[model samples]
Target chain A: MKKIESLSEYRALLGENKKTHNGIDKNCFLLPSGMEKFISAGKVYYRSYDQGILIFIDENSYYNLYYYIEKGSCFPVFSCEKPVLIEELSQNGSRDAYIAANEARLKAAGFGFYRKSFQYEIGIGAEEPQRFCTAEDEQAVKASGFRYDTACYADFRPQIISLWKESLDFGDISGDDLALELSQDEELLTVISGDGAVACTYLYEIVGRDVSEGRHVVTNPSYYRKGLGSFVLGLTLDHLRAEGIKRHYTWIHEQNIPSVRMHERLGFLQNGRSSIQYILK
Target chain B: MEEMMQILKGVRPDVDFENEKLLIDNKVLDSFDIITIVSEFNENFDIEIDVEDLEPYNFNTIEAMWELITKLQEEG
Candidate 1:
């Protein structure tokens, strides 16, 4: 295992791999102020072994109006579980072998057993237009200063792409050469603030079989305590209710109570989270 | 490493400098510290790095960082 002491040193080595080979993503950024607090008071380190990367973020301000940012592919599955470092699993390690290693790490680290958690994936927009919202109301809401800026998919392509890197859990974000996305098939709307607070959403037409899903409703850190989550959800529901789109799905990390509460406040009920598995080695 | 020296000087002039690695070791640069550095690097180098590059490796040490910055410059 290599101990990474400096950002530059870590980068030089990782440049030989995906951590560097992959370009930057905008939505993945943390507010500079929040980062300052973390740096001055917190310690974050990443270890690169022959197997894979292990990131440790310490001194995190947990349960204090939290937000879910970057996560690995298994995040949705792992939920509250951090991978236990055992003898690095071989690239060819069996699934059972990896699971065994995790069990060993948990036992060794004394990491308590984790209870399975559930998250929701609501089905939205499968039905025809029902409730409709006028541009005037949308503008008035923005003019009132509660909503920062209201831009629909048509109005928000560059806007969405501008924050696109936030979508890292789903794909390879490289050479896309664009910020914001305008969808012929999907609709997205969001509001951004000068302080880097973001709570916007994407509305998909259908889900799992024909089920529709609401991609996300995120409230940035700067505006965490400001009820921005409710505001975004209010707008989304208004829009969905108008178009008669219902049964939408969104993911909330099981541990983020505030966000889950916000969603529940907006009438999003819970569904189960399918387990996500990974082999880092 | 020179890129790092120049970056550090531009961001923090209050302190005398030595090994670029000392900045991280001495607690002068942390995560947020790293963000500011990346932001500044973007402005000065005309290269863009966002969330995907937030690894400790990218800006952990001056000499170590040159590899990524140089690569970005080339890609640019």
Candidate 2:
């Protein structure tokens, strides 16, 4: 029901509402609280309770929420770029009823529609400072095999995590935790070899089509001189480009020199695109 | 072991896969390595790996990685 327009406004709304939600902890919640940088040119909007039953609405992009329904104690609706194709949960019975009513309201108001991807895109290759292209280092770098394999979120950790624990950087990330984060859709990758793997880059979250972001790129001190960091990103970039994606992004701390340089090498030269997650006890 | 060594050396001439598990630890491979490897895997093996498949497990140790390559090849 609430339509927040500007980033500042969204922040204010988020601060006010995040406290009201349940199931969040005070510590270890690393994600955006309220963000609205639409990948499509149309304005992006998000409105959700503190518990994160948030709905991202963009005039440009689109989603089909009704298609994937997982029933539990209650299935919170996820992904409905348009209300017409969606149905929200309801307190009276199910979230679907609420979504249905909301859909009717939107239809009556003549506001149900699809906009486009955000005007600002995280390109892969660009001569510009912060711009990017679909693929980085194409035809330039040969596959020497020291190639790392990267995946996302915590739920998707494999045996290699425990096998190669001594070489982790990114400030003491354990294999178990990393695996769980991978399940959360966080971007995770590894540069691998026979006796070693060097850098590992991962993001806490990646959403929608406009942009996908990685959290950090952790390099092994032993492999500092080589361009392993660039290699991981180049691989990710090529995969993304192959999928017809237009933009990609990853969050690097302001002071992480190596990471910033690596992202710069990959062409994600923006100053910042971060969302602080709020946890409730 | 030989195939894994070949992949590792292909990625970097100075790689030491003997006691070093690449994905489990950041030793010889890094971002640059991942890109090159992904390209090679995609081209040499003729398989399209989705962005979602990029992870440590996919290219962790030589044995684990060989499993991925073998599986992908089989799937194809």
Where's the lowest-lDDT run of ten residues in candidate 1 chain A?
A85-94
Per-prediction DockQ comes to: 0.03, 0.01
TM-score: which candidate is best? 2
lDDT per residue, candidate 1, A2-33, as tens digits? 33455445345445544533332121244333
Candidate 1 chain B: 10-residue stretch with minimal lDDT: B24-33
Candidate 2 lDDT over A203-272, as tens digits, reads 3233433235554455555656666566656666665555555456554444556666656655455531
TM-score of each: 0.35, 0.35
Clashes of each: 33, 79
Q: Where in model 2 is the C-alpha error above 4 Å?
A: A1-121, A125-145, A148-175, A183-191, A194-206, A271-281, B1-76
lDDT of 2 by residue, B6-34 (tens): 65676555455565575534424544345
The per-model lDDT (C-alpha) reads 0.45, 0.43
